[model samples]
Target: MSRIVIILACSLLLVACKSPEARRPISSKSGSFIDASVARNIKLNEKEQAYIKKIMSENPEEEYIASENGFYYFYNIKQADSLISPDFGDIVNFNYNIKTLNDDVIYTKEDIKTQNYVMDKQELFSGLREGLKLMKTGETVTFMFPSQKAFGYYGDENRIGLNVPLKCEVSINSIIDN
Candidate 1:
């Protein structure tokens, strides 16, 4: 009898703990919310593109490569064996400095210790991860990314702000195969 009572209590608790999406209020204006979100994202993308183009034009001497994923990068130093790069699941160690396109430094390697992450596994900024994948050990490069690629609408909520595009100077110190 006690087992039956415990089982009923557990079932009730499970039913009460439904996911937020399952418990969300269904509103007649739900479609409008989605439409507004899409429109806002489109505008932000346009702003980021314009900022990148302006920066590129300002630095006429530096050659920049545009990626299909909507970012740009230029390497200051390239590794001799360009064919070798970090693969997914590999551990990569690097130092980086992050800044706004307006040249305001947000963070740098000096502010923290050398960083390490599993390539394509950790939730490091998407743009930084993509840029790292393009580099081999001992290569250093600067990558510029749109707000969407960097921090999206909310930004980092600390050093970075909302809808801000970013640039990162990355040095790939090493890549350890797992």
Candidate 2:
């Protein structure tokens, strides 16, 4: 009986000493979903860019400059005398109207109302935020943004639709330095 008890204890100790086994997932991902999404986004960006290019080409009278931040803009009222646009942390008072690429109005200046944006400190859309930095006081510029630059996959949750590019005319009333 004593020998049996000692053997059982030894067996139990040996069993407990076994290394933990790694678990095999029931289903493994091949990363297809992420790859497909990336490919789709790339294709979408290309199509939007081509369309914007067409619009620019068609409008020979309007001079549009492509921004480094992946948008296009032309000055309706350019202030050449101002040496610099609004810097970071500046309080910018502006008004803007939104439109589709086809020039369909989504939001009028009165509908949106005048905006007071604290540069790089407020919760504004990515494109408009970047666009504001390129504007001086009393300058109005019309910006053409790709969907990704504007709102990306999610629209404005109201009038704007999914993956819709936009044209916005922005006028800066004043820029108060912070």
Candidate 3:
């Protein structure tokens, strides 16, 4: 009957409109798409790292220093004398401005209150933590972080996008030793 044909046609259309996840080709042996996704992520990460390095090289005036863990930084206001840098469990109060490698301002000191963190507490991004450890109170530094050291592949999911590198200028206001 005409009603039966109409129903079958609608059902066919519904199946054809299935979500992308349902339509994705599955691997015959593994039965999942994780391998392809991971490969794509790896490629993206490599591209991000190369881009950060190129940016650092282009800015000769900044005098960026590369660290073993892949973060790049240079002091804008170096600490004087033999001032002690923060150690584990020390609480630090600071102000910062964070931008993307493309120079898009993501956050600034004016956007929020003074940020504070306990040293080596994992309360901050890996690159920020590492840079802070090397700085003494009242010092300011500008740092560049590859995606892996900042937000990784997922990013902050808000101001930052996937695989995006970051730049931050931080001023250490005070350190409260525990």
Candidate 4:
């Protein structure tokens, strides 16, 4: 009787673990979110030029850093982990503002109380998601995300137009295990 009861319990547990939707794969239409023309005409402003120059000069190794799939470059990382084994899955809480290298404000959530956002490895763009994953909590890095990794080479027409260059200021606040 005890053996039969144990078998029944195991069977019930197995059945409970199955979800009808688990076997199906998520599908998305092609070109549903792909744009490649946004980074086409990027013009850097005086202030942006100054900052880029300063950072580039301060960190000569920056030029050596390879780019990801998009225009984003990981350079002069203040407190990044080693390249051999970088942390790419950590959850980073940060406050970011999107703008054009020309200092044109594109997106800002300054009114929010926390002014911070959480980024997951798979949830963000290829460049941004990969870039932030390389940093530790409390790490601050400035990266220029070309349209390819951003809204794609073609930008969101309602927000930024096609082929426009964009920049994002990122500051990692904390790391959370999601």
Candidate 5:
């Protein structure tokens, strides 16, 4: 009986001394799906950029300045005065209209109405959010955005479709410092 109790104690001690093993995943992922998706997106971006270049060539009459932020623009109404542009927290009153590269109106200014955006604080789209930073009060600029800048994989979930590039005319009514 004493031998049996000693054997049970030895077995329990051995069990407790066993080291833990790392668990292997049921299924291992090779990341091939993510890699393929990234490659596809790159191709799509190149195609869209080429399309934008084509449009720019066709409209050589308008002097469009390529923005460092991956978009293009031309001032419809430039402000020559030394008025300050909006900073991080400034309030901007603006109106804009959206159109396709072919000049098809997607949303009229009335459709969008007036927008009061806090610079860099609001949930504005990437393209226009950066575009607005270049404007002063009473300046109207026309911006041409690539799909990546406008709406990438997911569109606006309304009129703007998937990966649709956009042309927009934005006019800043006022810029109030906050």
Candidate 6:
């Protein structure tokens, strides 16, 4: 049975290697291409799995509810302050930092020394859209997004592999238009 599993895993990796995108950017230094197929086979430690499952089960403490995408999205608002931003119909400017569940910095505007974009809510996941709706100009919020509402089971292996949990902190600097 183990042999069969190994064969199946190897086959999946081989398939990943044959893709056009696969030839461009491999995942890690180990030379393994981490695509949806690879993420499915990537072994998760018991602690990693447990932590992700735990985040999946958390609930918010305020009137603002998460996107119901099954991930816990929390915020840190100063007392007597509420988060408000552009409506779903408006565009907003935001800076952010993305990290692995283990707290490893995967991507960040500060680190990359750049800013992120959400074009009129046209190209973002559910959690990102919902999180922005809950923020105001000059407000900073941290969001914990599970794989489902995020990249889902199939992610961009060149950027972020599948089944990998992610955490992000977003700072809404200004609302250019609304």
User: Which stretches in model 3 have alpha-carbon errors above 4 Å?
Assistant: 1-41
lDDT of 5 by residue, 1-178 (tens): 9999999999999999999999999999899999999999899888878888899899898888989998999999998984789999999999999998889999999999999999998899999999999999999999999888997778888999988989999999999999
Measured with C-alpha atoms, the lDDT of residue 91 in candidate 5 is: 98
- Which residue pairs overlap in candidate 1's backbone? none
Q: Quote the positional error of residue 46 for candidate 2 in Å.
A: 0.8
TM-scores for all predictions: 0.81, 0.95, 0.73, 0.50, 0.95, 0.56
Candidate 2 segments whose C-alpha is farther than 4 A from its true place: none
Per-prediction tally of clashes: 0, 0, 0, 15, 0, 2
Ranking by lDDT: 2, 5, 1, 3, 6, 4
Tell me the tens digit of each residue's lDDT in model 1 across 21-70. 65666655558888998998998798879889999999998899998778
Where is model 3 poorest over a 10-residue stretch in terms of lDDT? 22-31
Misplaced by over 4 Å in model 1 are 1-27
Candidate 5 has which clashing residue pairs, if any? none
Question: Worst lDDT window (10 residues) for model 2?
Answer: 79-88
| Residue range with the least summed lDDT across 10 consecutive positions in model 5 | 146-155
Against the true structure, whose lDDT is highest?
2
Rank the candidate models, highest TM-score first: 2, 5, 1, 3, 6, 4
Per residue, candidate 4 scores C-alpha lDDT tens digits across 126-163 of 65676666566556566776555577545776787764
lDDT of 3 by residue, 1-178 (tens): 9999999999999999987765655645673588898888788777877887898788878877878777878889987974888999999998988898888899877985698899988568888888888888889998888887898777888877776688999999999999
lDDT of 1 at 82: 56
- Candidate 4 Cα lDDT to native: 0.58
On the 0 to 100 scale, the lDDT of residue 115 in model 6 is 46
